[model samples]
Target: MLQKAFKRYIDSFRGFSKEIWILALITFINRTGTMVLPFLSKYMKEDLHFDYDHIGTVMVFFGLGSMFGSWIGGKLSDKMGFYKIMIFSLLTSGMLLIFVQFVTSFIGMCFAMFGIMLIADMFRPAMYVSLGAYAKPENRTRAFSLVRLAVNLGFAAGPALGGLIIMGIGYKGLFWVDGASCIISILIFATLVKEKKLSTHENHEDTEKAVVKSVFQDGPFWIFLFGSYLTALIFLQLFSTLPLYHSEWYHITEFQTGLLMSLNGLLIFFLEMPMVTFLERKQVNRLKLILWGTFLLSLSFFVLLFDNWAGILIVSIIFMTFGEMFNFPFTNSFAMSRAPKGHEGRYMALFTMSFSLAHITSAKLGLGIVSRHGYTTNWLVMGILGLLSCASILYLKRIVAQSK
Candidate 1:
């Protein structure tokens, strides 16, 4: 039975195209080297001697850059194609990462963070659009999960290694490594993957039947984005505020915190593909799964309310990891499905923008609450937000069903 289960797990990874595999590899390399983010808040506070409010403000600029990058990347992908944008984003952002470490003042750091992220995050929507070009329709959701697996796997390694780098040569080492990795990942991609026209893979049936409505006109899609925004707002706390909580509340060391963060990635690495495969085969409603995920996310934060035991941190992370595994892949697939053929980049840009917006809000709001009220109050606020997100998705499901 164990052998059979293992085979099944392996089988879920089969059948992807060569391009998809290459994309996944690039994602892995890029994310693995991109370890600066998981510890950025801590770096600001401890290394730069910034207060919580300053860190939050810097992060807001980071998110603003991400938002602008997503919008531009998606627009350019439709016009110039995903390949050029991907390469440009990686190369420019890699160079930026190396220089960002030199910026010490609060204002300088904020601009540095924003500029780096603006270049770096431009890769996101373009990458998503590339999957549509590369993966077969039948295998698309699994393809998203495959890339996500690479991301999580990279994340699993990145943070643990980052912790060591910090302990040894300090945070400066992280920036150097991060910059090199981005350049390396892009080199691999550029050498192996030739550019293809975005129109090459367009589904004629999809285009012919597609209404081509403006993203703003799509009511259900807007509802879905709002739900996603809220879910992301809560989930992003894992990276932003949670690391500080680990130190201040639990007295967990930086390495210990990295390991804890790594657990989220490890769980997604092992379980996300198989779970996504199983659900796809079962033909489950994506929105329903998303609602369930929102519930888990909310519960994860509520679990943190029981702050006495360190073991509770493990349990809370488990819930949050499961929430991520369920929420993210389906959300990607659903957003892709909603896009009309020619406007895929626009739709994807909007989808990614929701998360960027959430990233903007998550740090400032979460850190603000922590500075003023405390962690317990912040967690409670996040839990309530999660519930609201769940309700939004539930309503979205009904709207979709009635429209169908």
Candidate 2:
């Protein structure tokens, strides 16, 4: 029985195409070097001695670059193709990582980080477009999950190793490793992944003849985007504020913090795909799953108020990871579902832009809250926002159903 169960688990991967698997592999490789961003806040505070306000401001710049990158990357992917955009992004961004090591001044670092993120984030929308190109409609959600699984697997390795690397070689090791990882992924993609072809039908016989609908005109998508944005605002705290919180409140070392961060990725890596597979088999409502996920994600922050930092953190991260599992891939799948064949890049760009916007708001707003009102108030506000996000998802469901 155990043997059969394990075989079934292994067989689950057979659903997606080989191209999708390659995409997953590329993501895994790139994310394995994802040591830099997760620890950027800590580096800023400790190594550079930046205040909360300056750190938040730097993050806002990161978000601005991300927002611009996604918008332009999506547009470029639609026009130029995913392979070109992704290859360019990976190569250029990798070079920028090494440059980031030298910037010591606050203004210089902020500008450097922005440039790095701008080039780096272009990969996201292009990756989303590639997933749509590769996966069949029925396999779309799982395809996204598979890519996310690769991401989590890489993340599982990155921070845990990064903590040790920081101790041994210092932060410069993070930059070099991250840069090398990006170059490695680029080589893999350039050699292994074939560009998806554009048929005459999708292009309307030529690029100029293709009719692209404005994302703003799609009412249900607008609602969906807003709901995604709200959830992102709450979820993004994990990157921006949570690390600092862990260091300060728990008095933990960088390795301990890496372990805490890795816990989220580890849980999602082992369980999310299987859990999502079960949910799909049960015919769970996608919108309902997103709603519950957002709620749980929000509640995870509030769990900090309960007093036992160690145990509560473990429990909270579990809930947060589950919430991430439900909302993230499905949300991307939904955006893909809504796009007309030729408009995949634009639709995905707009959808990704929501999270970019959230990165901006969450950092500036969350850090500001902590600086002024305290972490307790920040958690309370996030919990309330999460409930509001749930309501938005329900309303979004109604809008989608009405449109159908």
TM-score of every candidate relative to the true structure: 0.90, 0.88
**Candidate with the greatest TM-score versus the true structure:** 1
Candidate 2 worst ten-residue window by lDDT: 202-211
The TM-score measured for candidate 2 stands at 0.88
On the 0 to 100 scale, the lDDT of residue 113 in model 2 is 80
Instruction: Judge candidate 1 at residue 196 and give its lDDT.
Output: 72
For candidate 1, report its TM-score: 0.90
What candidate 2 gets wrong by more than 4 Å, as runs, is 42-54, 198-212, 240-260, 302-305, 308-310
Which residue pairs in model 2 clash with each other? none
Model 2, 1-404: lDDT tens digits are 98976776776677877788888988998998988877898999999999988987898889889988998889899889988999999999998897788898899988998888888888899989887777775567888899888887887778878889899999989999999899899998889878885322332111111124776677777778888998999988887678788777777787877788778877777677777777766767788888889988988988988856468878878888889998997788778767766677888899989999997888778888999998878888888888888888998877655655
